[model samples]
Target: MPTQPKVIFFDVNETLLDLQPVKESVANALNGRKELVPLWFTTLLQYSLVATVGDRYADFGDIGAATLRMVAEKNHITLSQEAAEAALKPIRSLPPHPEVPAALRRLQRAGFRLFTLTNGGSAALQDQIGHAGLEPYFENLLSVESIGKFKPHRDVYNWAADEVGASPKDCLLVAAHGWDVAGAAWAGMQTAFIARPGQALYPLAGPTTYTCEDLSSLADRLVD
Candidate 1:
């Protein structure tokens, strides 16, 4: 059997929590538009990449606000600051996917230490984790805010490993986002791809260590 990881770092957002409701909310808020939410999310990610490539950084909240404004303007919807902020509020209260709690419980019971790393602000991440009843499972909740950079950045993954006192080789990163897994792998951590449908794989050079349909499957691999 392969040796088990000493620490497992989970990605927030679509990995553990479902963002569909927030997407739908944004769609409705934009007057029944179906693709506005996706567009906004894509824009948010694009800007983060820009920041990274340009050696600039911005908080997730600021990126979110700017993305929302751009989306609204593109769709010819005039939104005030209050409206933009309100539209993005659902991010903090997104419910965990149905498979999350049980899987996390199983992982905890199996003696695997857990932690989280997200691009979301610390306060927002705390609210979402608390709302999903997942706060108890994590040994630590880490955010890119602390490192002043976003994921796919080597520093964030290095910081997470250091915080948990785990060597990169002994840490496993679990994430729905391919880019995150790619980054972790590049940082010398093992990676498990939570293959949520419709998400694409990152064009990284090395293969991921494992792929699963959801957290439950991932937990089974970790504990078995």
Candidate 2:
């Protein structure tokens, strides 16, 4: 394993916050077809990368709404952007995962600097963290909005490291998403993959420094 990093940057959605509530809200909007939530989410991620590659910058929420509309259209359902945004409203107030608070405490007590890095807009990110009462656990919240590019883009990772005044190798990215982990790993940062439900590593990506089932397990391994 790589030595412990000086700064540990976390991916907010799904990694720290439980997305079940948001999923439920989306399910309601999709006429109870809850199975489609994953597809919508994956499409959101895919198009965020598309936006990045196409030199277009849009808020994560906007991309989410657009993807939801696409998903709706594909299924012969109609969804307006405004309505889709309303459905995704739960995202701003998502609760942290059950083990998240305690795991963060453990990591803080172990003297590692913690911060959040996300593709979500800064205003919405602040609301999410504040609503979840996770503000005190992080030193700062970083957003790709400022960079105009999304995760899995090498530039975003590099910019994040520079923004925090840390060498890429001295930073550790903690995320549940395969693409996020891959991006950070390729950018020369250490990575810890939190295997949240339905999450998996990209088979083609290089190995991560650590892989654990949850934040608590990751904390245990980190502080051991």
Candidate 3:
């Protein structure tokens, strides 16, 4: 029989909430340069990692607004700071993906402690789950702000396990991002990769304990 995790750590962004709506926001902010949506997002994540490596800490939301301004400037799109902030505001209200609510409840019912660890800060994460009406399902919401680093950093994963009084080996990280799964696996935690559309597992990462099409699929494996 397979071992069950004592705790499950979820990733908040694309893993739980649908980011597709933000794509439209980005496209609009870029002056109809819809194609820059992906690039803008990539830049945001890249800069977040940069801060982590430089021994500096910045909230993901701050970095997001900054990066949006940078992306606009780079493309000579003439975006204003106000417009960028407005564009990013939609994140606060993003809905959970179709399968997320049921999947989370399933995991919760399985005798596992469920929590979130994200690059997003506490206030942002709380507001997000609250907006999606998901706060009830999660026992706690964690953020990387404490360590001043983002996900995929080994310390972040270990910190999460330590914070909740769980051993790394007994925790399973479920995320849509390959890099997050890779980091958790490297830290000796179990991992489930949610293959959300264009997202793919990293070829060089350690094998995932579960690879499913969505959160529901992974919950199915864990619940029954």
Clashes of each: 0, 0, 0
- Estimate, for each residue in 151-221, the C-alpha lDDT of model 1 and write its tens digit: 88888899999988889989999999888999999999999889887787777437888889999998888
User: What's the true lDDT of residue 138 in model 1?
Assistant: 92
Models sorted by TM-score, best on top: 2, 3, 1
Ranking by lDDT: 2, 3, 1
**Error of model 1, residue 45, in angstroms:** 1.0
lDDT of each: 0.87, 0.93, 0.91
Which digits, one per residue and each the tens of the lDDT, describe model 2 over residues 110-208?
A: 999999999999999999999989899898999999899999899988999999899999999999999999999999999999999899999999899
What's the lDDT for residue 2 in model 2? 71
- My TM-score estimates for the predictions, one after another, are 0.94, 0.97, 0.97
C-alpha displacement of 138 in model 1, angstroms? 0.7
TM-score of 3: 0.97
True-structure RMSD for candidate 1: 1.5
lDDT of 2: 0.93
Q: What's the lDDT for residue 43 in model 1? A: 90
